[model samples]
Target: MNRIELATLIFDRLVSEKEKLKTEFQNSDSGIGYFFLDDLLPNDIALQIHDAFPKTEQMVLKKSLREDKYVAAQMNLYNPLLEEIIYAFQDKRIVEVIGEICNIENPIPDDNLYAGGISMMGKKQFLNPHLDNSHDKDRNLWRVLNLLYYVTPNWEETNGGNLELWPNGLKNKQITIHSKFNRLAVMETHNNALHSVSPVTYNGYRRCVSNYYFSKSPLNDSDRFHVTSFRGRPENKLSDLILQLDTFLRMTLRKIFKKGIKENPHVYKKEKP
Candidate 1:
């Protein structure tokens, strides 16, 4: 099915849990305001999305101290199903409803898919605890929420690749959200939304469809423009220190260059035929 039909399904599922999700998010505001909904679409349809994922070789590999995963924002290079699902989350009706649920006003989806789109983590791949960049590609809008839809079938908690949220910072324990099949996790992104993905131990891929919602206002008054900052897991103190230094250098360059010495190549640039 196409984006419009798929968006209708997504909108219906979200509305079904509106009150429940709102309460879940509001109660978690003490830390990270977030909620996860399971079985977001019909079983068969979700499986179809799994089948449509591009091979890891076809996607861009982002490997460093910060993260190791395959990501694709150049949707035209992949299956049409991938593009449809990405834009389905951008559908105006769906966007408005999600904004309402998260208490955000005029939330906008990145059609350019800046640092947004699909990602997959294979064995040993992990995303270090980090805060996402505060704004959209142009530094114009504040990124307010992260929408992650996991499509890996029969993914288990023991298999790793789960999402971990550090509400109280690295000094404290994290809240792990299993990357279960057909689950959608929506979390507020701001100054303290530091999160990571557990390293995958299983010899399989944990695929996810991601999107971000942006707003004119920052989620918190204390929020400011910053690079996507990273930290090591609690056990790796040295790595944490190194990542801090990395963040410092990047932030310093941003101050001088404004948009960076070279434009970030992570954003999508639609090709005209």
Candidate 2:
């Protein structure tokens, strides 16, 4: 199916569950609101998305102390359906419905897909606990919501690669949200919204579709300009210290160069013919 048709299907599904989603988001713990829906699309369609993911070499491999995963923002380099599904979450109707559920006004989707797109992780790959970058590519707007759609089939929690929310910080146990097949997880992002993906133990890939919604105002009054901050798990003191320092240096540079020294290359530049 085409992008518009796919988007319409998703919009109708979300509309049917709007009230349930709103209640869940409002009552979530640790001051960070969120909601997840399983079987978001038909099983066949979701499986097709998983099957269409490109090989790891075709995507950007981000391997560091902070993360290990393959990401791709240049949609033209991969399957057209992948791009269609990614942007379907960005459809006006879908965005508007999400805004209403999260109780936000006038939320906007990032057309450039700054730091947003598709990602996949193989065995032993993980992302450390971290807060998302505060704003979009330009510093003008605050990133307020994160949308993650997991398409991998029959993914088991024991296989890891699940989403972990450290809402009360690393000291307390995290809330584990299984990255189940055909599930869509929407979470609020702010200064304190720290989250990460567990290491993948299974040999098979764990694939996901990602998007972020931005607003002119901050999600929380205390939210301030901060880079993507990382922290080691509670047991890893040494790594935590080093990551803290890493965040400081990046934050300092941003202070001096409001937009950073160079343009971040992780954006989709639509081809014009």
Candidate 3:
């Protein structure tokens, strides 16, 4: 289906249960608000998106102490359906509906897709707990919400690669939201919203379409500008200390260089040809 058709399908589904989603997000635990919905689209359509994903070689491999995953933001390089579905959540109606549910005002979707797009994880790939960057690509608007849509078929909680929200910091157990097929998860992003993805154990890929909504105001009054900070899991003390130092160094650099020393190359530069 085209972008409009796909967006309409998702919008209708969310509209049908807006009140339930609004209530759930407002009352979420850990001081970080969130809500998820399964069967976000027709099963067949979601399956098509999974099938259309590009091969591993075609995507950018982001592997380090922080995380290991494959991501693609240059949408034109992949199947059109993948791009369509990625932006479907960015549709104005869908964005407004999600904003209303989360009680956010005047939230704007990022066209540059700053750190937002398609991501896939294979066996043993994991993302350590971290807070996303606080602002848009230019460090202008505050990032207020994160939208993730999972399309990997037959994916189960046992398969791993599920989203882990560390609402109470890394010392406590996380709230795991399985990256189940046809599921859409929305989470509020702020100073305290620490989250990560469990390592994938199954032999197959767990795919997701991601987007972020920005606003002129911070989610919390105390929110401050910071880079994407990483941390070790609850049991890894040494690693956690090391990551803390790493964040300190990066934060220092940003203070010296408002935009950092180098440009982040993860944005989508739509091809003009």
TM-score of each candidate structure, all chains considered together: 0.98, 0.98, 0.98
As for model 3, its CA RMSD to the true structure in angstroms is 1.1
RMSD (Å) of each candidate, 1 decimal: 0.9, 0.9, 1.1
Query: lDDT tens digits, residues 209-248, model 1?
Result: 9999999999999999998999999999999999999999
Computed on alpha carbons, the lDDT of every model, listed in order, comes to: 0.94, 0.93, 0.93
- The better candidate by TM-score, 1 or 3, is 1
Please identify model 2 stretches exceeding 4 Å from their true place: none
Residue lDDT tens for model 2, 122-155:
9999999999999999888999999999999989
Please provide, for model 3 over 1-273, each residue's C-alpha lDDT reduced to its tens digit, 9 standing for 90 to 100: 988899999999999999999889988944789999999998989999999999999999999888999999999888999889888888999999999999999999998989999999999999999999999989989999999999998898999999999888877888999999999999999999999999999999999999999999999999999999999888878888999899999999999999989889899997677
Cα lDDT for residue 174, model 3? 89
Q: What lDDT score goes with residue 241 in model 3?
A: 91
Q: After superposing candidate 1, which stretches have Cα over 4 Å from the reference?
A: none
Regions of model 3 farther than 4 Å from truth: none
